[model samples]
Target: MSVLERFSFNHATAKFWDQREAVEACARTGSGIGLWREPVQEMGVEASAKLVQDAGVQVTSLCRAGFFTDPTPAAIDDNRRAIDEAAALGAPSLVLVSGPIPEGGTIDSAREGVKEALAVLAPYALERGVTLAIEPLHPMFASDRCVVTTLNEALDLAAPFTAEAVGVVVDTYHIWWDPEVWRGIARAATEGRIASFQLADWITPLPAGVLTGRGQLGDGCIDLKRYQETVDATGFGGPIEVELFNDALWARPGAEVFAETRAAFANALA
Candidate 1:
């Protein structure tokens, strides 16, 4: 099969897409899908799971379930629900975006909070057979978005746990600028910690808030093909998820955006 055969589209790439339609599209193309919690909850987790099951679409990973930079009982409970949802959907991984630095807290303290939260939740995830994939967002988002900003840092956070229970997400848009990314990928592979692989280009002149500015595949400066090769070289055989958070793409029809994203993914790999 072609390399693109393993490409999976993250539903958040087209943020407003009907979940069922996106799942159906993946089924049609024989591709996998990465789902988000809001939409899945809107449809009800069990209903969402049944939809993907009926469509024969593989749920590659759940979009997120980690804001426990300052873990609370509620935070831990919420992630447990997320893990349950992932298990119900047959998704092997639950992607995590470590929450921002807490009020009056330093980044260092926030990272410690993440470790504590993981210590509490990792066993829960392990029990349910879901891997918690810590996603290191770009440095630009460190203060207000995710505290984890490097693969190495994420790996260190995951180091205390078994590979099956905790891992890291290697997304091009997030870590492409890290000088040690190649080495990080290698280490992640050696440790069996690569749970999710996503593609999103790094574009400049980011929009306000910078949350919705993720560029489409091949549209920006990231060497996506190189990332694919590097990850493959490391023996990571998981789905390569295309996950652009661009407003322009979201404003279009979901099916149209899905088609374009899939084409861009195939071209990037080609």
Candidate 2:
């Protein structure tokens, strides 16, 4: 596929963009989309599914559905709901962010919560034809965010289950700085565990809280082209979703942001 054809825009890139408009833009551009649960729920799951289906826009993956570090019964129930939503929307992957370290819990204990949660949900996800794609955040987020901080760690977590049920997200913004990232990519491919591939640049002077600080393509030090090339080398032919969490991009009109992000992706890859 050409660059535009291979692109999938994650809705968080333009946080306030109307879900309908984002779906329409992806349809018009022949691109895919990564949807978040809130907007999908706002429109209602069935309506959201119909919107994408009618537009012929592939929902590459759902934004999130994991925070089971504490793994309460409520967490499991919510994840089951997320799996159902992904199936209804025909999205192949549901992104999983292992939640923060619980009070009176160590990182190791929190990781075990993830494993326990996955063991419970993996079968359900597989039954629903959704892959639970675990996304490792930057180490900065280790305490209050994702405890899984490396692709290798994500892979280890996924190893207990079949790739069809659970897998890892190779997101550049989070793992670009890891020296062993290439090895992690290769290993993921070898194990058939790369369920989702996302792109975002890493720029300095992270915004307050650093949550919405992901830079646009070509705006940071990440070698976007090389990262794509490396993943492609593993023979994982799948949608490449550009998932930016940038305040500036979110402030613009959705359509404009969509167009600009697509161009930026192509140019950065070029």
lDDT of 1 by residue, 1-270 (tens): 687789898999889989888998999999999999999999999999999999989899998899998888999999999999999999999999999999999999999999999999999999999999999999988998899999999999999999999999999999999999999999999999999999998888777747888988888999999999899988877789988888888899999999998999989889
Cα lDDT tens digits, model 2, 187-237, are 999999999999999887777748888989998999989989999999988
Question: Which 10 consecutive positions of candidate 1 have the poorest summed lDDT?
Answer: 202-211
Quote the positional error of residue 263 for candidate 2 in Å. 0.6
TM-score of 2: 0.98
Q: Give the TM-score of each candidate.
A: 0.98, 0.98
lDDT of model 2, residue 128: 93
